[model samples]
Target: MLYWLMKYVLLGPVLRLLWPTRVTGTENIPENGGAIIASNHLAVADSFFMPLHVRRMVTFPAKQEYFTEKGVKGRLKKWFFSGLGQIPIDRSGGSAAQAALDTAIRVLRDGHLLGIYPEGTRSPDGRLYKGKTGVARVALEADVPVVPVAMIGTDKVNPIGSKMWWPRRLEIRFGAPLDFSRYDGLVGDRFVERSIADEIMYSLMELSGQEYVDIYAARAKELAAADAAGVRPAVPAQPSAPVAGDAARVPESKAS
Candidate 1:
């Protein structure tokens, strides 16, 4: 009820008027089944604009800090996100990471549209970054389709480090759902997971028309921050093998 009230009556109208997102390919979304909406992380506004344009409720894994903060403002943040059906997640690695993944699987199994940023964090620059394999693991475990979603122009509306929003042209594009049924029996294989993650990122790159950086977005941010501080950043270790295969062969989509 709260979600409906806020979306339709309270905030939706205002947001739609302010941003007026142009959406396409919503026909690709399944009417009643669970699926992962894998989107590129560009800005904070990606969360709000994506949900605003979609018909179904999108459950995203939010950083645990949002729900753990104190004071009236913190309380309000918790209330708003909770009411929007976001699941609190601990980004710290180890058991907490596994726990967050488990929660996401449960949501998918229960037949909900799960929204995830495969890049893990927003791009420090406006380019797309390499995706984490967590998305692939969850899709395999929960047995759901992965739909590539492109959120365009959100970075302008809510750029990084900007405290307020600006009215900007926004668009949300949904690509055709990707099926990984060919790799159905191989869940725990890291190579298979990496392949899937790369494929998702490839689709996002094509849809959003953003330059693809092979490095992780978080690491890129760290390196960028280090440069700004006049400090040298440590070189990241290379992966065991190159990231290539079917993902590379996937055809690019026509961006609007």
Candidate 2:
């Protein structure tokens, strides 16, 4: 298959020789069932390095643009990504979020590994950001375990806006699978979802040893852009205080 050829035959050897990756905690991956691989978003290479180290085929819900671009180069990109088994989800329209959630559930129901970045976007400054509740929703709906993964040094090798990857050592650390079975039948409760999301982020914070920012990464990037342009950006109000259950799940020290 294309995925095998690319990972094992074409790109795998090249990456192994150049980057020399070290991965740990792969045993945390469930062998016979669907599970969510929740990872910190550092660089675009995070996608490649994570999949290359894991034995199973990990499918991610990528943006639609990756599959719809035009021109020869675009076609090649489409082929490469498609061969890797990425599902495209449209990021527009009122129903876009629901569609992507459905796709994620379907992937899990079929007994496959689904990779997701709960932060929604890559960290702008190498710090972990607040996680979206979508990951919590999917985990609860699909009844699958969520494994927190940390990719270190990927950003240096493939910095944002860099076309070619530089040779560097890469380290991936996988934390134990988090079971949210206690929250069963509590899906759709916003408070419950927030608690779950915070717990996942807390686990990543401990595993990655990155400062946890209370705000979303996308908003942080916007603020940075505004500062660069010398424009005063309207500061959004802080998020509401977490519920009591959330406090227990995510310690105050880590979040601050």
Instruction: Kindly report which residue stretches of model 2 are placed more than 4 angstroms away from their true locations once superposed.
Output: 233-256
RMSD (Cα, Å) for all candidates, in order, is 5.4, 4.4
What are the per-residue Cα lDDT tens digits for candidate 2 across 61-126?
A: 898999989999889989899777688998785799899999999999999999999999998888
Backbone clash numbers for all candidates listed: 0, 0
Per-residue C-alpha lDDT of model 1 across residues 185-219, encoded as one tens digit per residue: 77877767888898898889888988877788888
Query: In candidate 2, what residue range of length 10 has the lowest lDDT sum?
Result: 236-245
In model 1, where is the ten-residue run with the lowest total lDDT?
247-256
Clashing pairs in 1: none
